[model samples]
Target: MFNFLKKKELHEDGTFDESGVDAGDFVDQKPLDEKESEIYTDLSIHPEWHLPEEEVYVYRFLNQELPPLQPNQVSVYGVEIKEKDGGLIVDAFVRNSLSKGIQMKPAAIIILDKQGETVARQPFDLSAVGTIPGKSSRPWTFLFPPSSIRDSEKEIPAQGWRLALELKKKPTKHSLDLSDHWKESLPQEEAQRLHQLVDSMKPPKAGEVNFFGLDARQADNGDLHVTLLIRNGSEQGLTLRQLPLRFEDRSEEVVAEGGFKLKSLTVNMNTSKPWTFIFPAESLKKTGFGFVEMEGLSSTEVMEI
Candidate 1:
């Protein structure tokens, strides 16, 4: 209590002060791990520009292997049109960045008939946005109305139309090399087997009615609980007996009150019929197939988790 003059000075921020320490003193810093470093490096490599008040990015094609289109190359992007109730709708943005000033050009929306003849060719407005030097402007919206096409007495033989963007100047050509992600992820043999199984399990005819949906969740004991909802869509009553339900990877039979024996039940048609079944959680983790077969009815397989 008498040596009060030997007290050290305290900083207001509660941090120790080393004013006398040299600025060149070595300090150890931990290096980032491999995964952490990769993530940081990737974010800095490709920077994306955010659109004003828009959520989606504007680009002709995404995740394709083609070389980046030059500032002058013209390309079209839209969904394929099929002959249905409503005629096809085209919503695409055109991109072209050439010399300075705003360029306006007349574009053609050509529709060809089945006999290789041009049925309709309508003119549309095309504008270019000139913000960055040598950067092409992207088209906002180009619509082709369905009423513009001619209706055939028998059937419309038209396949699809192309919005040809006639360019003033031919830019440098570039080749795009697109790689498929799905092919790389799955083995060729396994992928083919999955495709075959899917092709075989086509949905019933529109008139041949059936109603079904799946309810799946994990239990407290980590087992996957799956419930099948089957509703009768027909007029007559249907009988189900000895229904064999299977889990793809699971070989164990579900224990029932009747010692694993199959039971028959009469389900009235046009009713909200329900059937409950359970499978182990491990069955879903493996790559295999599951099915349910009843007499006088087609067997159905469970594909999705």
Candidate 2:
């Protein structure tokens, strides 16, 4: 009775198909082409591991370079620029090559507009990490807010601009001050806590001990517990005798600090060691402290057993 009112169905290719079903619909489609398979395979890899975007513009800058004055003393590994919070953040990784430590005091980044005129000269007070150890690299980040650069006489050209790092040279043979440079900036109690933490661990050597996957939070008892995933890059097993750590605020002020001994001293090579430090309730103020800024391995030796 109502069968005559049913609408006809059409296949994707646009022909009415009144049969129960067509042979094409039952048959399996052909396997994807070689090129199509490759596309699916490429999507599996993480995008972060891919190369930096390559877009053409007016300005050109080198990502990495060796300073002419003391090529043997230090080298800039790379520079990365990121936009955050309506500002530009510049991160520079610098390495020390000399056996002696190198200081980056009077450190500043000079931004130049077209025609090579200085647009803004922002100085960095890396008091937190005043000196970098020999054979090690550390990151220095500088932020440029939109309001900070809006007053510039010359705007950043579409062609791009230059970012030059100007640093003063200070060569000291392992005599650089390792104490909490954040002393003046942090609260008295916080500064004292940091000073105590750094005192326990010795300065870390590059390629010796590196930190990753750090986590920190307050415990039920009001103490601050910090955990770090540390990797031993050396060939021998490491028995940490002294490990010091510090937490700093955005202003480079120390907030919480502490360290602990490993129950099992010897950590195997190419293995990750989980270390936790606990700061007493009174170590930090009532308010929440900021992120981890500074940490180091004070004294350690190769374990034979």
Candidate 3:
């Protein structure tokens, strides 16, 4: 495999100097259209191989300029939705606008409601869709059977709902540090996502970090496992040695309170990190509850050590 990573020289001023680097080093060595299909074909067992010949042609298309995909850039854009055979058929465009010819692995095709809530989800062996060339937007029909439908019995409204691709893998990369200007090196979609995530959240006061609740669940032992998002919108990174947390319930009552030791965990400016903290059974004041108030945290005192 060719390394798509670009190596550059970082200077004391945080600017990169590519004086000796050739511009052609970044260009793809082989044209995507010229790539042999042998490398793109997956010989392993796949459910799509059993599909009818006519149905198989729905997603199969030829791409001459198959370019490499930037991480997490593949997405589908829906053009039409119709009811057929007591199921839903989505005519959509599988877009790989970032880079190179690529084939997708098997992944779930998700349908979202008007409110962006998942109404249906079904897995598909996307490799059968064939080699999708880079800078390409190909049309394909995805059939979601009745069994996969979770929405109401009423017919799914075609005009309102949206198409979405589930994150097949957990994201390991986070936003860059305040001083790092290298986020430009990231895929355009990824950089935009991180930027929007930070901007969408009403930032905390200047020079301060906000700890908000993302999710919370009570285990069988009544241990409240809470997932918190540490959002840093400051100009520099900050270290967390300790944080006192109060878990509140739907009634605005504190169900659990604890001081979590973070051991100098650093949160870079303009970045967010999620950490799950388990409030021991003994520490919880309530026995049975769900949906802890994550928004109420805004008014809670933030203690940083």
Candidate 4:
């Protein structure tokens, strides 16, 4: 039984390969010389033996930035309006002709009277529509409630009513790898460790964001539910990934801490959008946690303000 575990094999250079080596073989084997030892040591540090998962991820976000919104990037096409249920329903198609992806907000339609005076300004929200990929088009619909089209002293013009559409520019795409096991591909906790390390560095300046109209309450499932409005007040759109959120009580102690993400998208310029953040069950330890404030973080560098 012991003899079966041993083998006598050697390379032409008189070195024993591990595949056929036994404990007793090492007694007569020659030790590797200085030159051969250095060669083997250098091969151990080859990149193929290690993964650059964290460095790849860190450099990805560090270099990923949204391009500026160019003129005529997004345009409204094939719009048709009809009256239904005492309201006006708009059937419209939007096309993104650029080579970059875009997320569209609601387009505005300005109704003008026969004399070119403004009659009613209606917002045609398009949140239900899917994202328009680069050099692609998508369809969306909007309805103007009857009450929204009424004027104090006049009805909608029968023949001279004109509609002007305003298509707001959307933010360009910023790529991030979302592959499965992306957060776990690295070894020795390097992924999380490097993420925190790079996140602490100075961030590049982009668009400005502000929060307002906060509403927080407890849901039926015992989770804390929050809804707030955010506005991008900068001249250009921004790719926003996370928002810093906290709940505090009258004593100024923290109760629950969390952040929000845009989930592979960005906000439009000068656009106000609503976001909802939910804290899981039993997250709040204090019943007096009544005050809440929210802040935004830069997507490219994870810097929070």
Clashes of each: 8, 5, 10, 0
What C-alpha lDDT do the candidate models reach, one value each? 0.34, 0.43, 0.57, 0.45
Q: How many angstroms is residue 277 displaced in model 1 relative to the true structure, after the best TM-score fit?
A: 94
What are the runs in model 2 whose C-alpha is more than 4 Å off?
1-69, 72-78, 150-160, 166-305
In model 1, residue pairs whose N, Cα or C atoms come closer than 3 Å (at least 3 residues apart or on different chains), thus clashing, are 65-177, 65-178, 66-176, 67-176, 94-139, 96-136, 97-136, 248-289
Q: Rank the candidates by TM-score, best first.
A: 3, 4, 2, 1
**Which sections of candidate 4 miss by over 4 Å?**
1-71, 113-116, 150-305
Tens digits of lDDT, candidate 4, 236-267: 65566766777554465776777767574454
What candidate 1 gets wrong by more than 4 Å, as runs, is: 1-54, 58-87, 97-102, 111-120, 128-133, 137-139, 150-161, 166-305
In TM-score terms, which candidate is top? Answer: 3
Candidates 1 and 4 compared: the better one by TM-score is 4
Candidate 4 has its poorest 10 consecutive residues by lDDT at 37-46
Model 2: weakest 10-residue lDDT segment is 37-46
In terms of lDDT, the poorest run of 10 residues in model 1 is: 37-46
User: Which lDDT value does model 2 have at 294?
Assistant: 34
After superposing candidate 3 on the true structure, give the runs of residues whose Cα lies further than 4 Å from its correct spot: 1-72, 169-305
Global Cα lDDT for candidate 2: 0.43
In order of appearance, the predictions have TM-scores of: 0.26, 0.27, 0.34, 0.28
lDDT of 1 by residue, 1-305 (tens): 10122212222332211111111111121221222210100000012344442223213222121122322233332223333344434433333223322233445555444454554445565433222222233334444555655553335432333334322232221111112443576587855654443234444332233424334445666554444434343444556664545433235444221211336555454332334455455544443334443212333432211
Backbone clash total for model 3 is 10
